[model samples]
Target chain A: MKSKAKDLTDEELHQIVEKAKAKDNRALGRLCEHFYSKIYRFIYYRVNSIEDAEDLTSEVCLRVVKSLPEQKGLFYAWIFRIASNMITDYYRRRAVRSNVTSTGDLIEEMVDEKRTTGELLEQQELRQAIKHLTEEQQQVIVLKFIEGYDTDEVADLVGKSAGAVRAIQFRALTVLRNMYVRKDGKS
Target chain B: MEQNIELLLDNCIDEIRKGKSIDECLADYPQYEDVLKPLLQLAVQIENLPQPNPSSEALSSALINLGKEMERNTAAAEISEAIVPSQRDVLPQKGFAASMKKRKTFSFFSEGSFRNVFRKSKLAWALSTFLFFAVVLSAVTVSANSVPGDILYPLKLATEKVKFFLTFDSYGKAELRLNFSDKRLNELVEVLQQSKTLDTSLLKDMLDEAKLALEENEIPVEKASILTAKLNHVNAYQKTVLENIRPEVQATDRKIVDDAINVCDMRSRWMRRMMNEEYQEQYDEQDTTPQSQTPNRKRHQPKRMQWGEGCDWMR
Candidate 1:
């Protein structure tokens, strides 16, 4: 049922893109509703603050609206590309301010109320481990596993070939497995 | 071996994610179970990790804000379109010589087949002429009231450049430039009076232009006197305007305002001296106290002098 619903949205995406390009506010609103949670989740995992994630998500939506007229190609890939660039810029600015390269440190500073102490600790460990991966590897893992993008969709998004994406995913997962075992041994 | 195992594991994970049991997926890749089992299990765990989702309230608020922004952009565009025709209609027709010169300039560009084509159709010629002048005039009038920080300020300066180009005489050009300088001062005063922050750089540019005009010494004495009088009139309100703006004025801007006031005073004094000299000559020529002959003259003299003195006191 979930896959069917996902397929339904995927089919409607083309019409949604057309209406949004025509500046139909209702269509844009629907697009925002459909993508907001996914975009927010993507940003939140990297930035680790609900407030910053929400703000960045809003910025992404605004950019989508502004650039929709000139944008072509797959809507999903195009929208996520905007998201990816905005996140990179956000971190670059943050790095300039704090003189730090690790976003995981910033994530640990956030006050998340949704998770218990153990869950937060575990999530933090996961985030830190992911942060240690190369940026491409991290993007692959996030897009493939968390956001549930298929291999080809991930390839189109990250501008890599399918084989490259698969390789990146494999490497990222292997790194996570090693890190998970090491952390389990420590605990 | 490594590449083959990686592909098999990748396929197994895809099947497992699509709702096939781990047992079923491994059955097809039993040779690589040692490599696939832990990797697939880790992938499953990672996929099930808690991720952040935007609250519904945040989503609704963002959508509302985006709607407001879109509405603002639409309204602004509509207002600009509505303003264009009315602005064109209000522009005063150009004088004959100015219009002819403009036509000559256009003809200069309309060389080759373009000129013949333009001349062939009387209606097209008339339409193009009207459009040309209308666009030029509308831009000027619309930009006239634009303050320094406004988007139209550059257009306002460009219109002044066009005026300079159209003026035939040197002194006329100087006078026009001086008037633009005065216009800037007035805009500054108006903005200051409204308790809005003035663009200090524009104020400085205006003062510099005024000073440059005075130093050029090309303006006729009578015309210079008129300009000086206008400056003095503007300066009269400067004190009140400055008082309103004092708290907001930074050190750099305060210096600019002070320099502008000083320039106004210096010009006013010179103009007053020139006027008194002219009055003395006229009185000498009359050889009698003509106060009885020109009753209004006696009253105007004191009033004009008093206005100059008011500016002096403010300085």
Candidate 2:
């Protein structure tokens, strides 16, 4: 579906942000619409449940709408920060509710779902493997490869030097490579 | 170096981004082909993973939620503005308090009635505040011993973040990070010992905390050296513990634990190098620049050989 927010240029997005801050309901709706899918996908990759992803995306939207006037720094980066914190909180709540001992169990539950086909299962495994990396590594991998950001763009979003981002990407890929080789060996 | 390899990998990635096949990029660097091929393939795999879009229903619901929140926030802002004392309200007026009383508006905050209510409730307020602190203190104390899956563990991590943010001194922050790393390691050990499923995130969190601690600047050289030495000792113990637990970890989690052990090994070597450099600087007094203030020439540390006695980086 064509999105009004997705078509916006940097200058346009900035204008929308300013207008949204000034209480323009239409601008605020556009801003939320623009980031909705990206933020949802970001959370979806980290989480197993689509419902959880949607709920968290909504919570992030609420936070963005409420906090936009006082927000500083890069807008995309700020949204990602909120999304990241929400994921953390989501896991905490999950931990409290389910008392699951490990992330591996969660992955297994995902795998055991009736709706997961072989391809979807593989995707789920890959996501789980990515979670094994450090948070910085995960951020670099997701932003650079999954989201198709360049190294410098990722560095800007992640607040790391370009060199650091590359190094992180390299290490993350190395770990992922090992996981894949192991899976191949098992099969 | 190692930095060159990172750059090379990045260049290959850029080429791939520009529509070159992975094989073509690998062909350009045959010397690194063995090292780069699998990683590039994995990168491509990740890139090719299905890009999930939010369902239209979700989008509409999110937009509705945003609209509701915007309206609520606007209402809140207006209400707060009206309640906030203005210069006009501060000026002497005869019927202001009476009118506010008749309307039961929030303007009663400026009237003596609010003060009388506060005075009457002082003991109750004090008692409730004390009870709140008592509960909070006990929860924090209990959370200190909680592990990753425990109900109180999130509180423990949150309390740590709050403490870390409140600590302004660089060295103090660094120390706090190291301490938190230690806590994570302990949690890992506890989870392992309890035969609970291994939480790889905790291991990753531990490594991240240590990395942040080691990366912190602005500490005195002597203190940094001491800190590194302390970290080295802790890391050594961590290495030993991880090695001992290797056989017990489930097959699925073995790779993650191995990666964390590799990180610990790398950190150990980095600390060793840092301590050596500090010692060398101390001996060579002619170089007057403080070692801590000096630009870190070694931005990328080489990965060390793994533990000895047949212990490799991974299976």
Candidate 3:
């Protein structure tokens, strides 16, 4: 739960939720002033598309409304978890539709069309290296290295022991190292 | 021969992640200086790239949508509440009372008993069946577009709220958070129970809270299992009590994930199941661990993490 203040604190977005509970229209309008943009940028970076980012962002808002009266958690992670699930589900469904071909493979092939050659190569390597990792390892690594969450948050996001997250991180890095050397890039 | 700094690899990864020059990090950890320098440099080169950040407009726009959604929900609630008492007058005057008032006309349509039954039977039954088929077909068609995307749950404060629109893809899936109050959690348990994906820790937390309210409020035992069975995952947002929900939900989630495995089992295709099982087992395993078991790793890695350069980093 967020702390209450006489005047709404900067983080006092919950004020909107409270007013919303009482069926207050203006308070809900105030909430719209607060969270929409942050959620959009987060989705933009994660999915890397302007259109998809907008859809996921809107979906997140709709979800927040229908489920607001019932949700519990800090504002950011609560929403981020929702966004992550949405993205993961999207990938899973896509993977299914594309005849079982890995999204990572699709990422590599699409890299040239989507980004500069330098980033293209970098993302390509990341795509290849990620495939070699266990899915858990990949998720933690994505949340940590790619998504900019710290170790503690990554553990929270994945619902695992920090030690387990660490060990997975260790293994993930080792796999990348192997892939790097195996390609003779470092050799 | 080069030194293996497996112990130092962890910190080195952190250093690499932080965008520090490998040489700088090498000097920071003097004890592993010799062992970690090369691995550190290689990792630094690889992981030095910038992380992505969302644009400034994203959060603001999401908040506005939330406000719109809340206003809409509140209006809907109010409108529904205002109309409940008047519903009787709203229905058509074609029921038993109307039939009695028009009894004289009724006999003209059916004076001969069985003749009355046969009067409009064909027409009425035809109309009823046609209406039913139309409804069923429309419902199926309307429901076809519905997936997990419909009815996103938002977080409303038990008391005002804090919250979103995230991103849109070509498919443009909207993201919503599920927020529930203590009492609402009980109701949610029922809903989630049907889908079998409710967050069990929440069920348990709701149970405990419901228990606390026992002196003032009674909680049925059946509600507890109903709560527990429907939980699929836990959220970061929490009530004043039971902040430890993440691990609890994960523990439960790990179990429900097996349903997918059961699906895999249903395939009867040995190759697909075997491969999926291999992946599923690892995630299913992570789904359950004690809450306290998380967040204890030392920030320092034994060595810097290098991809493509030192698969030997582990060695």
Residue-level lDDT of model 2, residues A36-124, one tens digit each, is 88788777667656677788999999999878889888888888999999988887877833311245534544555444556666776
Candidate 1 per-residue lDDT, tens place, B1-315, comes to 767766776787678778987778898767777777888887877777766568766776667556555444433443444322221211222432233233332221123323332233444546667888999789888989887677888998887888778987545765675677678767877676665566665566665565455444445544555655654555454434545565676655665556555555655676567567766865685776565675223212212322223223232
Better of 1 and 3 by lDDT: 1
TM-score of chain B of each: 0.42, 0.53, 0.18
Per-residue C-alpha lDDT of model 2 across residues B1-315, encoded as one tens digit per residue: 778889999998888878888888888779998899888888888887766676666776776566446545544443344333222322223432333233332232244533433343454556667878999999999999999778998999899999998998767998898899889888988998897568777787776687677677677655766777877988888888888888888888787777777767876887787778767866676377676785444322223334333223322
Off by over 4 Å in 3: A1-50, A95-116, A119-135, A184-187, B1-20, B27-68, B83-315
Instruction: Please state the error at residue B197 of candidate 3 in Å.
Output: 65
lDDT at residue A122 of model 2 (Cα atoms): 79
Candidate number achieving the greatest lDDT relative to the actual structure: 2
lDDT of 3 by residue, B1-315 (tens): 112354356666666565666666677668776545544544444344333333435444444455345434533443444322122221222332243233332221122422323333444556667878998566555543332324322212211122223422211111112222243454434445456564544444343332222122122332322222222121112221233222333455644323322322332233233335535654565577566676332221111112222122112
TM-score of candidate 1's A chain against the true A chain: 0.81
lDDT of 1: 0.65
Fnat, one value per model? 0.43, 0.68, 0.26
Best by TM-score: 1
C-alpha displacement of A16 in model 3, angstroms?
Answer: 6.6
How do all the candidates rank in terms of TM-score, highest first?
Answer: 1, 2, 3
Each candidate's TM vs. the true structure?
Answer: 0.50, 0.49, 0.38
Interface RMSD of each: 12.3, 10.2, 13.5
Candidate 3 chain A TM-score vs. reference chain A: 0.57
Please give the CA lDDT of all the candidate structures: 0.65, 0.73, 0.46
